[model samples]
Target: MANRIRASFRKSARSPRAGDGKHRKDVLDSLQELRNSIEKLDDTVQRFTFYNLQMAALRVGIDLSLFSSLVESEKPLAVGRMLRYLASFGAIKETEKDTFTSTNISSTFALLGFQAAICHYANTALQRAFNTTQPAFFWLQTQPEKLALFQEYLTTNCAGMSTFLDAYPVREHPTALHPERVFFVDAIAFRNRYRDLAGRVVVQDLAPTLQHAIQHAGVEMMEQDFFQLQGIKGAKFCYFRNIFHDWPDNKARIILQNTIEAMAEDSIILVDDMVLLNAGVHWQAAQLDILTMTMLAARERTQEQWDQLLQSAELKATSIQTYTASLEDSVIEAAPV
Candidate 1:
């Protein structure tokens, strides 16, 4: 699959008209402009925005029930007949004079993935975030750290790691929508839930996010303050993603200590974050490192730093797995001494 994907990428890049990275730059340039405007990013910051408007449209279509309504309706869905506000977005256009229908794009976004009863769940979560994340949004209105600015977009505090647990959209019990999102705790557990062997997943998170998850299944809500953790003892595996990037070495050491304490003798703890490549590395990791600094007052780690961190808590790194060959995110797995 990886080879096929790489082949497809090579095929696309070998286009006769466009030279290497030309088409990519053109596509990213438009995106950078849009994000600059929407995020209110500084006019000086040259960053790409890429298809964000389409994502906004997709989010809207999911929220308004427009796609579902059009699917159920036998007739075309004209802009005028639909939400008065949506006429401007051009989500659906007039097929005949004033007559509109659900475009193929809209249909794919809604119907492609979800339970019939829970179709609107994501919409509801976004609505909740819209209300709760307003402060962070207002603060982020064109901050230098545009991406990490979203760190507080949902949670009020600068406490980065806790925000994911508190602000994650997929609450309401433990249904593994995406294994990547779940952060591989136990391969068996992930496999079981992925295959639907586990009836329903249960997750523990902060109050607000947990409340949302509780809608489907009442769950134990626990705020992330690793120093105070006593539960989860003797677990075979513990996983933390994008967590260490939020704190400095000292605080991160404390978090690792707690994780080590929670693990069983043979348990593994996976830290998923960007590890800096000192040599000929892609610009992506460097960009994220800057964002981390600007937003959280933290920085991404190097492989040496990661090893040092694990050793700080008397843990040993078993392996490091980088996604693709890009300087993107990676997983460092460690086991307690």
Candidate 2:
């Protein structure tokens, strides 16, 4: 089994067609399980010790702003023991003796959201887990700095994740869309993708969010509250990405209903979110589920839950297109009943 796993890893690294993404994930998970089963008790205990120390090192490196420094330097930076430690763990690559370069993991650690997540998890979530009565949104509102960081985190996360456009064929829509009639709600991260689409893209978000958004050429920015009536009427596509998952069903329905009222007969609601399986949920999706629950008292939906939620909002999914396999990232083409 160990030999087979090693061969599979080598093949996957070298050959494009060695395995599909889903197969690769399965193999990795199996290898992990196998390692756990065969490891000695002392090694398992030592592994926990190593992980704890790694996390401490990671946090310390973030405090030093080392990751971003490495990423921005472009050329390899000469470094010493601490950097060598990080390189050994694959957080960075050792280009030469006593010199290190940033890896994707290190680059990611440099992102504001990624750094903010460490702060949030340690200072906010863990500290307040037992006693805090307020949900993450409400709590964040009181801490202006943390709120800004959280918003940046959301933007970075949305931008980095698989987009709905990759899965749904917008050009293939049956109804011809009018120019300047596409409404994207709470979407500031998809500026580039929206730029090339047939219609005009009006990005709607809260005033605070609009202030931070990088102005994209030809994209209209508008302040919006999804709980209130949608301002952009008769839009060809009323799109919401990574929005509905932040709220519970009742709250989600309110947002959907507001948009539904503004939809024309030909209009569609494009919802980009995870559509989890009833069983065998992916670890990433499961992690997000817990995150939403911790932050907002919300959960990622199953297909049945999505169907039910849309139906309650007087709409139905015309088609569900899955773009990412393991995470089940999807675009739900929805229309009013």
Per-model tally of clashing residue pairs = 9, 1
Look at candidate 2 and give me any clashing residue pairs: 180-200
The models' CA-based lDDT, in order, is 0.51, 0.73
Instruction: Give candidate 2's whole-model lDDT.
Output: 0.73
List the pairs of residues colliding in candidate 1.
31-49, 31-50, 32-48, 32-49, 40-142, 77-100, 171-213, 172-213, 174-201
lDDT of 2 by residue, 79-197 (tens): 55456557656777777766888999899999988888765534334226536677555565566777688777556545444677677876676535555566444444445655555
The segments of candidate 1 whose C-alpha lies over 4 angstroms from its true place after superposition are: 1-202, 212-222
Per-candidate TM equals 0.45, 0.60
> What lDDT tens digits, residue by residue, belong to model 1 across residues 1-337?
5466557556656767457477868645755665465542321231343123234445556767777777679887654322222222445544553355666545655575742433433223222544444333233333445534444442332222222232222224344333223332422324333454332223444444333332323222345556555356554346676778867788788888877766656556767677765433344444445445534556677787788887887888877766534444677767866
Q: What is the C-alpha local distance difference test score of candidate 1?
A: 0.51
Off by over 4 Å in 2: 1-3, 6-134, 155-161, 174-177, 183-191, 194-198
